[model samples]
Target chain A: MADEQTTLPPDDPVRFYQVGSFAVGNRLQPLDLRTVQAAQDRPNALTCGHRACQGCGEALGARYALDAAVRATDGRLVSVNATGCLEVFSTPFPETSWRIAWLHSLFGNAPAVATGMAAGLRALGKSDVRVVAQGGDGGTVDIGFGCLSGMFERNDDVLYICYDNEAYMNTGVQRSGATPPAARTQTTQAVGPEPGNVFGQGKDVPRIAMAHEIPYVATATVADLHDLEGKVNTAMGIRGARYLHILVPCPLGWGSASKDTIAVARAATQCGLFPVFEARDGEVVASTPIRRLTPVDDYLRMQKRFAHLFAPARRDDVIDRLQAMADRNIRRYGLLEEAAR
Target chain B: MPVQIEGSQAVARAVAACRPGVICAYPISPQTHIVEGLSALVKSGELPGCEFVNVESEFAAMSTAIGASAVGARAYTATASQGLLFMVEAVYNASGLGLPIVMTVANRAIGAPINIWNDHSDTMSQRDSGWLQLYAETNQEAADLHVQAFRIAEQISLPVMVCMDGFILTHAMEVVEVPTPEQVARFLPPFHPRQVVDPDDPVSIGAMVGPEAFTEVRYLAHHRQMEALEVIPRVADEFREVFGRDSGGLVRPYRCDDAETVVIALGSVLGTLKDVVDERRARGERIGVLGITSFRPFPRDQVRDVLWNASRFISLEKAFSVGIGGIVSSQVRASLIGHPITNSTVVAGLGGRPITKASLHAMLDRSARDELEYLEFLDLDRALVQREIARTRVGTRSGPAAENMLRDLGAVRSTPH
Candidate 1:
């Protein structure tokens, strides 16, 4: 088996085990090669015992990303958070789950705050300490967009992470700029001629960050722990402004089962609804290929947000349009492996 | 050594001497020259170890300062009327978080007619924002107050806003004794933040304080301001010993002793008020001018003590509460709850109309005769206002009041819409 694996090409897709590269940890892999989440001494930047809902993807994604960041910087990290679900849940007045230096300034100023943190640290002659700003989709793509763009434009030494949960979950699942088309949010009610969010709305913040020609920009999902951790590690390794957009499925917002958060996020990427890729200086450097192709219906049917499209009658017209979106992403990002294609 | 310099440049030099670690700049009228001066200093390497950020907006400028100050950097920023209104949220946040940031407010009128002129409306609008406000009466005071502002802010862990009239002070050139860096360093110690974002010691700074402890947090903020009532005068005294200048205090009582009536005011208007008082005193009128330097933590006791012998006092306000009479007079009334003192509110210099000696003399003469209205507008055009009111009553569509008034004054060509 070892000899056969050795003979395989570097880009070969075939693997001996069922889990293959999908598993976070493998006995055959070296300790350094294992994912940061699977490590024994991984810094639990967002430690347990917080007010996050069961199977909360933002909590999980933040832990994976921030832990990796802390590791990359050798435990020297200060995070500035915009007011959102992550901030509201993690630090409730006198209690906090954060293990690293964390700051929650306002709903729309995290990026600028992080920029100031970096500048402050540099001015204080503490160049080794790094800054990481974080916020939910509502905070990042909507209210915090200008500050984020400004931070990127200035090439500030800070890493900004956006945990895209599609809607404003903390505010009871209101439609946000990161909400997908035709998704049922509180603001985008499921009772209209064209039920749920309208098409041709919302923003693609990762692409916007890339447009700044920043040093680094990447998109990840909570389902891919290794990829998310690796992306954060890569981001922390760079100096200038870095953006990481991680798709964190909100079980409450999406009306998916608590245990299905990871599966839902998996379906999002595998179905090509969200293209996981990395870019450098306005150019795509790499993209994660889909291990298994999943249909858009399989992804949509799992969430009650999209249940309106399936029930009352299957709106195949809307479903087909969503499928087209997935196909476009698949083609654009080259998300399918050659063998799978 | 006193050198002839613009007020903004003098302030910028004083601020630089304090050695702020970070200075965020977002250009707005009047406040622009102050930040521009600092930016030049940063560029020239005269201000070493300072990160001068040219931010996108006033909101970002204040936000950046909040972050910088939270991370143990002595942060500074400047803004004006509309700019101050824009960053009002972060202004409250900085004070609530107890970050000792020093800001220069180039006082300008808040506008619907969009006038970029000097007034007390900007800082007056943020009176309850938990920031200690010090109004500068002169270019020299504007420069010296900044040095005292940083010390007072850091000592109490509350933000301080040093307010100077926008174009009147910011654009006006005068002989200002900008303190040396050595003098500033001696007065203002290295920033030792009460709470900071440190890797070795991690603590959440701005948290989601619910109703359980929210009131306590706010009460503590108010408590800190009350504490500042003592710190302000003490720091001013310390500054006097170190810098050899009495630049800032709760109130500067000019010729108030044994006076029957005191003219109370804030900002550069006090300079004119002082001149008016002197002229009136020369005419055998027992009148005095009390300049309020520390407007916030309102200096209630000192104001009451100074006005103890006085029978009446007039609050000459540049900004009033629109529907209500006076912003500062209300506080003055509150201070003299049962002191048998007659209080009046004189709203003057709305949208930067000149508060000249002639207008002051006329207003004071009326006050001395006890014929002035309880709430009066100094030099207001009553005929123009009556005409506009009559026109609005006659026609449903009276056009915009500002436009009609401007046309009446022949400031702009009247085009029928």
Candidate 2:
């Protein structure tokens, strides 16, 4: 990581981006594509003064996407939230930070609830209002996955956005189906010979969503605010069940510096570890290209949960396997927006 | 106008006329015909303006309904027995979130020795859920209750579970007053969810409540359910005023005044028991019948008043409380703890076994003879129990696991069918 060095620029674009412009915060993008950040207008659709934890990536991602969605729809969007950290932290009975019409559903059934909401709105001749159903990875990839698949299969008129932080953060960091490989979670300990999580396991929901062929399926990262906002805005344009799974790194669960939220998230995409791409009907149609590919170690080294792999002298094999995974993702999705070889 | 129809068909027709925004369902034995009829209606465009989500499991069914409801729609769903238990979590949330979704539960027994018959076990399991619960005594009541559920649920911003006896109400066809779409549209206004997901007023729902506010939130649910009693009567009065019928709102009494003997029950059992009561009346017996149509509200005060003068009370239930007595029978007994009435619990007609008229008359005869037995396993034969014991040791020293192992090894003697 960055070892408490004061050699950083006087005005860190990352800090400014949260308050100023979404595009202003990046240290890796070219000057031409460097656009203003999402919070320049301080929409704060999630607002402030809720119970979200420090450096909560879900909190950040939700606020950024929702405010952008509201802006895009021009106040014609309604959010159906599933029971999870985002729902719990934002609403505290009789009080809410949300400024939009919101409906809360069960932990494992947000997709179904959102489908109902959309149907309800349509019944009332209010099809102009778009529906957004949201939940954490635990709710999305694990508990509510079946219901989510049904929504997609039926092509329900709703945009389901999964703020995936890998684990069940609200319930004390247990292992979720979306929990990354070799992650030190409470359930998946770092004790086995292969260490944390065994490879070749866990549900790859994006590919599953693609199989449904429900018009649209996209994956984004919180590191790229524009990409996330763009995907949400695009999903809203579609009439059927649209899925957006965003990788939001949790500071508490990942054991990373609170400030490294965007930085770590950026490294994940840049290293080709978490491919950012959009697919339609099971085929990859578009992707956010990685201009400069970084080493997987750069991303893994920043998080203390992955510190075990680097601590025991050196784990060349483990690191190599991680790199291989990144390579496979890069080749599979063609995430690099740059020209192909 | 009122027309004779089966309870299941009445529910199906009412749902079709109401034109729900979405219908999610999963089949469970006795409750299968309700959804099956609904599916037919949806497929034939008889029930237009709805999406019939045929889910893989009951959990998915309820979950889908929850999603549809949250989107600000009039969602309708149904389930029974294992299906009800499977979707219990979503069922609780559908109520707690105050989504005015209506669900019809066909009461049936849960299984281990796997039986698929009618019972109150399933509904009793969900008694504490915040959904406004109402039981139907006849096909007409079952049909009328669906209309009332939509009205009551929409008014209170709560989910309502309209329970009907499995097989009895579900299979039997009778005359039911079917309201026209225009009349129903007027009686039950289209659902305008109090809490909606609007972009202009962005907010979160189903938020976690810590120790600070969990109790108060649950208390609010409690207060609303209690208030359902007030809303129920008004809706029923409205139904009566429009359709000129009072079959399915709350408890209905039959010859329960100044009587020495009273029989209390719910669902179609009342119809049969009423027949036997008439038979007994012709023979100069001082017996009366009190059919409890609303089980969730329990109707404790009304129950006491109905049976207060009776010397001996008999409770017949298709479902029983395993370790105790009849579930409803026990509840009725508990309500009369301070009052008079020698109440005896008799369980009958479990797992789809037909509750015959002769059996009903026999149970009454037994109660009259002071031969009232507690925890009477309805339709349970000793030969079957012996056969089961010979095949599997459930309550034995070997335990179920050992019996299973023995069966796997072919060591246990197989019984003849």
Which parts of model 1 are misplaced by more than 4 Å? A1-21, A337-341, B413-417
State which docking tier applies to candidate 1: high
Q: What lDDT would each prediction earn against the true structure? A: 0.91, 0.79
Query: For model 1, what is the C-alpha lDDT against the true structure?
Result: 0.91
- Residue pairs in collision within model 1: none
Question: Candidate 2 on B1-417: residue-level lDDT in tens?
Answer: 667777787888887778788888777777778888889988988766677877667887776677667666778888898889989998888788788888998888787655566777888788888877788887787888888888888898888888888877888878777767777877887677787665555556666577998898889888887677777778888888877778565677787786788887778778888888889988988888888766766777778878777898878777766667678877788888877567777777676677778887777787778886755765565664565567554445545643555455565333312
Indicate the residue-level lDDT of A150 in model 1: 88
lDDT of 1 by residue, A236-267 (tens): 99999999999999999999999999999999
Per-residue lDDT of candidate 1, residues B351-382 (tens digit) = 88899999989988888888888899999899
Interface RMSD after interface superposition, each candidate:
0.7, 2.4
Regions of candidate 2 where Cα sits further than 4 Å from its true position = A1-42, A335-337, B1-6, B39-48, B67-72, B190-192, B200-203, B386-417
